[model samples]
Target: MNLPEFATTRTLNNCPAPAKLNLFLHVTGRRPDGYHLLQTVFQLVDFSDLLHFEVRADGQVRRTTEIPGVPQESDLIVRAARLLQNAIHDRTGAAAPGADIAIEKNLPMGGGLGGGSSDAATTLMALNHLWQGGLSREELMVLGLQLGADVPFFLFGRNAFAEGIGESLQKLDTPGLWFVIIQPGVTIPTALIFSSSELTRSTKPVKMTDFSIASKKLFGKNDLEPVAARQFPEVADAIKWLGKHGDARMTGSGACVFCGFTQEEQADEVLKLVPNRWKAWKAKAMQEHPLAGLLDR
Candidate 1:
């Protein structure tokens, strides 16, 4: 793939696309447009996907590899590059920004881990720097919002208490925790869960300041759990099994369920107990997004 270029041979590598967990997701209401209103805490995890970019001279933005079940044109990585490219040309009348982007996809698709959104956010940040796009961090975030709701939060660069369909956010200095996340070897479609009649759309929202490490038990429930659990028995089983270990919650609209541990060894121990039928990962919580420093620049 070639991108409109002004003659540079720079390559950006090892840019990280981290995953996120909704420590708790609450659906408080539904908009006339059919979007669900949400309140939740988003925590970054050490687990991540990596993306590498190489400048192209032909002015074509493309993904170097084809993703299964995802068309190249529709890949968030490709779309994000195009969006930034368009923004650049619109801003400077420069040729379309172009690059051949290769993503190391580590996060599970449809696991509700914000993998795609994080990947998109990283693309925006990486390309902005690669092309000297001059768009500020906040500007790229606004641009990311057009790609997906979770995109802005990833760009926000910190753990956040989010609301209003999750575009609104307030940073949180959440206590670190280790997690044993189990995927039921199934994918939970977000749209299906959101539209399910079983989904609870009325949970009293809480103040961000009201959240405390001491009171974690109070905010541990995800309003979408019932729907996902009902639709996927594996989710129910995973949740039930993990609950014996600690406070188990479904992160976002997921088939992936997780339990938190105060120690890495504790999480590792539980990871060993995860049934062979499911996929388990031991991850440590992060205070900020892996690309948090990029936002400051």
Candidate 2:
């Protein structure tokens, strides 16, 4: 006989860590500590990488993926689990339950999608309930901040109006619009975009009131788009191709370009016309993250 493990004590193991699109990004200032001050509204997409975790009785946190260019010791998920474990031990005086994390790579590296941040959030959320640590969202988010700037947003698991170096988050009333997301098989180093001499360090911040009532209309331009186009011609090409059917913009300092479509068929039609070499995915808008849906009783 075979059976499904419906009575398992685990919470979120296989979770979706979606990519985010910054409707607009502005570098307001630079801190004395060297972290830049930023203001942006991060729109989370349904597209995501899958992270799976299995509880370990042996009490060890580990990663099963070899993320190219990312050191194992510095892996955000591992660091996040360890941090939570330490926090739990310090607070409750119990050895934290452990897990082996498996990351299914979907989002491209250096694509400005916050893939690492999302993974860290999932790890924290899953472990909190799995170990019966009884942590609130506030507590989890605090732990998340030490992992990365963007990790806290995913802890909330919704599209948000973010500011102050992407830590401050306010959930938005965003709509469900399909997207034709394309990656031109190129990796654009985020450091290059931020550090480029031509990068816009000074840009006026736009009021949230300026945004459209629906997600279909373009609220404003992506400040990183022009610089990214100049750095990677492939991104420019993808944008141009996607632009023919709908409004196209680069997500983050991306190698990935996205165009919004009111209808799935419209995006599908555009997909047929796109070159085969580019990595493309058509995803519908999710008001709540997949993990969020799973969490709700």
Candidate 3:
């Protein structure tokens, strides 16, 4: 990977934080610490949230944009920047720089699209480059895991087959299919779905080879979907409506349902027919993160 053209710039604008779809998620088991063991293929999509960062001379990390219901301190992007700033300071024995981050939110919160995680990963990568943090992609990934399990995958920069609470990843080539995503205007809490008594915690684990075969037919299912659908009727309605076109399924936990199409035209056709009540769009699969090249610096 080569360094991006913005390597020398102090301000990185319109930086993309792409969303991810769990093509298939299975709860294979549970860890003793209460974390669920998961098996899933994280497919990157063009749909994304944009972030802008300006280096701050005064050494104070700040978010210029305010997000409804999310406080500045609790925002993952802020946490990621501060974490990297501290790490760089510790490594170099000098004061690390700060940044002013502004987010252009596109992906819905609680929709299981991995928006927050992607934003945080983007912050770590962008600030690492702007501040000359000198952290390798692997080191950044290790730092990201402290924020969220899905955060490391955004930094991993490739579509992958994930296991072990979604941190253990192996590069996987997914089909270059287009997707029709439907957001049912409801937010489903992941914790609520996972904690449900009806949630399934045991699914037979399969190999990457198995996924290779199954990908051709879109043959896996999201185990948390049932729990989420039962708790939120809007999710079930969206799934039922989209299923008419193909094998529609909920990604990650809930609220958003999707169906794949081999052609962009086919995806657009379905996207048009989506109920006016729900938010719908189409995005082509991305083989790697747009900022994957930034790590080369």
Ranking according to TM-score, highest score first: 3, 1, 2
Instruction: Please report, in order, the local distance difference test score of every candidate based on alpha carbons.
Output: 0.84, 0.78, 0.92
| lDDT string, candidate 2, 167-233, tens digits | 8888876767788889888898777887777777677775666665534576667777889899889
**C-alpha lDDT (0 to 100) for residue 154 of candidate 3:** 99
Look at candidate 1 and give me any clashing residue pairs: 2-59, 2-60, 3-59, 3-60, 3-98, 4-59
* Evaluation by lDDT, superior candidate among 1 and 3: 3
Query: In candidate 3, what are the lDDT values of residues 1-297, reduced to their tens digit?
Result: 122346347888888999899999999999999999999999999999999899998999999998999999999999999999889998999888889999889999999999999999999999999999999999999999999999999999999999998999999999999999999999988899999999889899989899998787686799999999988999999999999999999998877889999999999899999989999989999999999888985
**RMSD in Å for model 3:** 2.0
Kindly list the per-residue Cα lDDT of model 1 for residues 1-297, writing each as its tens digit. 112232344677777888899988878899999988988889998888888888887889889876899899888888899999899999999986589898878899999899999999989988887788888878888899999889999888888989998899888877778889988899888889888888778888878876765444536478889888888998999999999998998998997888888889999889988889888898888887766665455
Question: How many backbone overlaps does candidate 2 show?
Answer: 0
What ranking emerges by lDDT with the best candidate at the front? 3, 1, 2
Off by over 4 Å in 3: 1-8
Total clashes in model 1, counting residue pairs 3 or more apart in sequence or in different chains? 6
Estimate TM-scores for all models.
Answer: 0.94, 0.91, 0.97
lDDT of 2 at 83: 91
Clashing pairs in 3: none
